[model samples]
Target: MMPRLDSNTDPFRRPNTNHINSIYKQNLSKFQNFSEELTKRYDELTPTKKILVWILAVFNVIAVVLILIFHSYIIKSLVKLSDKWADLKFGHLLLFTLVFMVGFPPLLGFSPLSLLCGMVYGFPYGWPLLASAMFTGSFASFLVFRYLLHKQAVRLIQANEKFRAFSDILKEDQSLLILILIRLCPLPYSLSNGALAAIPELSAWTYALASLITSPKLLIHVYVGWKLKSLGDETKTFATKVVDFVSILITGAASALTTWLIYSRMQRKLEIYHSSRQQTNGDYDAMIFGNFDDNDLSSNNNVELDSNDFDADNFVIGDEDDDEEEVELDEVRAETDQADVTKSTSPTNSP
Candidate 1:
């Protein structure tokens, strides 16, 4: 082995540097593109969601800062408040439900309430307690929108083409699928509830059932708030802190990934559904952007073209009268030539 140390023939020869670099570049490019797409989609969030994000961010920062500055006083006050509210558990729940019901609209989202529940009751108790409030709040909102705000919701839906298109999808028998997809979408929960209210066909029970089905997603936000409470605990061991940190990280990552996936899937479904709607109506642009009435559609359909006015059959390639004149002139010239030939032959004989 020592005598036959041929570098070229060695099995442990280094791989091609160019090939490895090419593979690395390809993977890097793919990852960059994937990240760019996610960024683009995130930037396209609805105005409601953007507002919610801003509010949550500013509130969290201000709260954290104030809590740090007045830590002892704040804790003492909260402990006193907790003691007073401890025996009034049902009252606390009822108050939360009332607040949620009042605020669970496009103007005010339910996310903050969900987090409050988690921070107050902890996850094991908080999840179910919040779920109940959410259910009640959802049902209340549905009733309010369906009855009290019916006209306004209708006006809202009619004014927005996207909402109308989504409403059309909900009008179908497969509306459950559409509603679920919309719920799973990273859109504002209030918007979904309001839009569902605008649809007369979507029964109150149907909306309630759908909310129950999709309520599990609230747990993700609750978990975040619950873990955040752990951060303030001074008695936690190093191992506990590490576990909580990891748990928070994993939970956040999973929630984000799940939201992105749902958004992507919902986007594809919307595109397909919108395209089908456009095809059905045969108006791609107007169907998407224009609020067309049945009268307008019917008027457009009733437009008629008269074939006689076009007269396509009477179109001649060339001038027929000019051709006839040319043929007559040619015949007259031939006859004149014959007459001239006869006259010339007769004159020559006489001479």
Candidate 2:
């Protein structure tokens, strides 16, 4: 009104600032209510879940402490169990075999324990027992791993690129050979078996074959332990030292050989891959040159045609006959005369 302003142009004609402020305040209140609801939901954990979490945390702590404090006790207990099992005669041998077969895998790494079994039980008893136990344990572990922890095991195997490659090798026909070599060598058996369980390509027969071949060392250990019971203390100690030394040497040599073979195979594969890459590059180069030549020729032809500026119809039109109509009329007249002569001469056409 002060300056005769139009009603639509007046700033004060718009909605009041207070109304917008009220709406924002309402929205903020709603958001706060929603956030409070979410917080309440988060606080409402189940009692069982809470208890389980606490229990697992406590057990993990205790396990760590026991491992640190009683490491020697754990080792001695395992050795004692092995000795006690070996002392049992035939009927008890079967029971001991079952127990040891189930128990020894986690305690002794595969090859050393297999050798221990052989040493304690002798060749005949140790061989069959260790082999059977190993095969059974491997099969059980495989089933457990494949069914229960397959995804986790596979992730671990794939995390290491080399292990993934080796896993692929194990899936092939030479799987048994690779397994035996790995077992005979210084590679970790329990870990390998666990990883092997995750591979879909590994078969029971391949696992069994590898176990049978690699188990002789374990049987030797059981045999040694059994024989040690009858020998004098000094002789037993000496024999133990000798067996340990021999095992170390054999394992070291086998490991070295396996490493060399793996390296050689990798080298050969790399060479083949390099050759293939070079051939591919050569073909690519040839294609590029051929394309370049064709393009050049096409460009030259296009340039020549563009320079002439010639119309395609001009040359063909110059050769056309102007008497084409007269020629067609004469040909039609001759054809009519011939048709009339033929009609008079022929019998069937005259009627």
Candidate 3:
């Protein structure tokens, strides 16, 4: 039963604030749902697996300490293998190391290898060697996938719902933009390689163009290594060492921030695409992004303006029109939408 308003109630108070509260609740509910989705897998872990995770985490901490102490020595030993191809009379070539980072299983990976380039070879020499290898390796992989493995890759993508959804988004005009964003993200090299490879229509030129945009990212690793090398000089004063340490920290923070922003923007795009798909009834939106609730495709997505009886003089300064309700944007062209204008103007008409 609806409660009747008191006749002597303060008119300045919002007479019907339920709509705003409901909107706030819907958003809060979505956030909770998202949080639950993220933690579901962790919550489901068995006792044995949880113990294993802790053991591995402890070992990882120990490994990090050991690596930090002997990192420079280890990096140098790895870089200077003394293989004839790697060791010329002039200087050691890091091409093979970078190539291995790009190829199957992807050992050591791009991050450590590029850092090794900067630390061992140092900049001016390190930047170009690593940059050229990244470009050429990515180009070669794109060709290999697009021609040699196209059929198998297509079959694999078709067999997976998630990959199929990813492929669909790639076909859009924003495909190149998406690729550039993915490159900027701090994901595994092989992961990005497989994703780009799956899209049969994605050209080598387009892939190269996206890769070029991320050229600055490789420089970040080299820059960090360069800074680290500066800190190792025994002759440097305390103040100089402090400055170098701070700069390395700042550079690392900046790189992390850039990757986070890029990843967040990509996520927002996916959410928007998910919302639009829900509106248009795209059944497959759930595969890539998680499946949403009725809140997603709410029938209440159109504007609804209603008044039991609005009083202008009763409105006080700093207080909104105590009774109005506004909903989501439902684009209505006046010329074409004139027919539906009388459909519903009451807030109660929607969910």
Best by TM-score: 3
**209-235, model 2: which lDDT tens digit per residue?**
777666555544565444433332233
Clashing pairs in 3: none
lDDT minimum window of 10 residues, candidate 3: 323-332
Give the alpha-carbon lDDT of every model. Answer: 0.72, 0.62, 0.67
Which segments of model 3 are wrong by more than 4 Å? 1-38, 43-52, 67-92, 100-108, 150-166, 282-351
Candidate 2, backbone clash total? 30
Best by lDDT: 1
Model 1 earns a TM-score of 0.57
Give the higher-lDDT candidate: 1 or 2.
1
Candidate with the larger TM-score of 1 and 3: 3
Between 1 and 2, whose TM-score is larger? 1
